[model samples]
Target: MTGSLTAARAMAAAAARLRAAGVADPARDARLLLAHAARIDAARVTLIAPEELSPEIAERYEQLVSLRAIRVPVSHLTGEREFYGRRFKISGEVLDPRPETETLIEAALSEPFARVLDLGVGSGCILVTLLAERAQATGLGVDISEAACLQASANAVLHGVAERAEIRRSDWLSDVAGRFDLIVSNPPYIALDEMAGLDEEVRRHEPELALTDGGDGLGAYRRIADGVMRHLAPGGRLLVEIGPTQVAAVIALFAQAGLVDIGIVQDLDGRDRVIRARRG
Candidate 1:
């Protein structure tokens, strides 16, 4: 840092700092941060790996590395995340899309629907991806944050689904009208007590509104159970992403709300990650 440093040297130093900070994947993160700072593809980092970094790039790289060392998510630092075979823009205002959520997407797409509703849409990854996959399908995505709505809208445009997708600021389905043939949500399920134990990147950098419902982790599920029956058309399907351990509680809430045909889907890790239900 004091003297001129090559890309390889800088990457090594950054990785060392991240390791000391308890980052789980220090070396890989170091290369990714460097790639963003250098405005180069990660695959091409090796070409510059042995080359000296320009002063400006070096400074920016160091700043990004520092942020990453402090537990900022790489997706947030880069402002992009890949989900459902597409790249989505991300920010502190929305939850970063995770691969586990793809289980919900897979489950939703397993059935057919002309209209879809996404609750707590965040960056609109679910609605957008679904709309993209089913070109004729239309979708409405709702979130409580105006910023999240805006971000979701932008993502819809990015994926060329803006014409068929609508992003709105709402808590669940409060202001939504009409019934959707299919509805999905990846709501906040982390209990208030469990929040303190979240990874530093999630606890410190991600939006809390998208992370917890401020009481029981099941609060969002409860709210959804109350509203989904009214919003879903007869014989419609509903799928929700859930924490690995929330299967029983969520299924009970849905069943109590009169939802039937309820089932569970597992992620690749073999953990229960999505709950599937249907309204008669």
Candidate 2:
């Protein structure tokens, strides 16, 4: 927070700064930042419309704005992001789940999976959401980042599914034991060379490991295809989120892994964002 907007005048002034700085939703962002600083919801801020915030809260709010001005994502500034229409806790340690990835969750949910595995799980959003939606299912969310595993585990508990969800640090399926009816992942798929062209917020705030596939952006797909069958039960299905342009390449990778009945699913925008295959 730069500081809180203590009064109507202060909020108006802050709004002007945000607008000048090209924040698309300046008023909404300012209100959101202020509400966070005050430890109150935006609805509550409206209730106290005529009042001035305490000095401490004002200062905090300003700091949030200052960070946002530097291109940090609003989700990061707020430490929360909405995925599959549910809120999840997130930080620099994990990838921020996006709406498009929800398509993968929905595809998996279309089947009544008894056991599920989420590789490269970050923030526990996918696995937790799966267990929550399919009450009879148990899940494991595996990630290389221990910090991310901890955060994801916390989210599982928060959503009342910790007992059914195990968040463990593993490089894909390596060092993990599992045979799941379903598997899914929203792994890092951006090529390192393309990172420089990403949006300011993504490049400036999101973790590079979670954004880039290290070099070709196809590395994650290779790793997943190589390891997926090792932990996938025969007849199980795997659903993975892929970049728009990566649909064909990842499909080929899955084929090389002996997966069959392969198919791609598109997002709302009609981009091929998910690849679903059955383990042979």
Residues 85-159, model 1: lDDT tens digits = 898999999999999898888888898899999999899999999999999999999999999999999999999
Across 59-157, the per-residue lDDT of candidate 2 in tens digits comes to 877788888776677788898887886889989988888888888888998878999998888899999999999999998888988889898988998
Colliding pairs, model 1? none
In candidate 2, position 67 carries an lDDT of 81
| Best prediction by lDDT | 1
**Candidate 2, which segments miss by more than 4 Å at Cα?**
1-12
Residue 134 shift from truth in candidate 1, angstroms: 1.8
- Evaluate all candidate structures by whole-model CA lDDT and list the values in order: 0.91, 0.85
Scored against the true structure, residue 116 in model 1 reaches a CA lDDT of 97
Evaluated at residue 56, the lDDT of candidate 1 is: 92
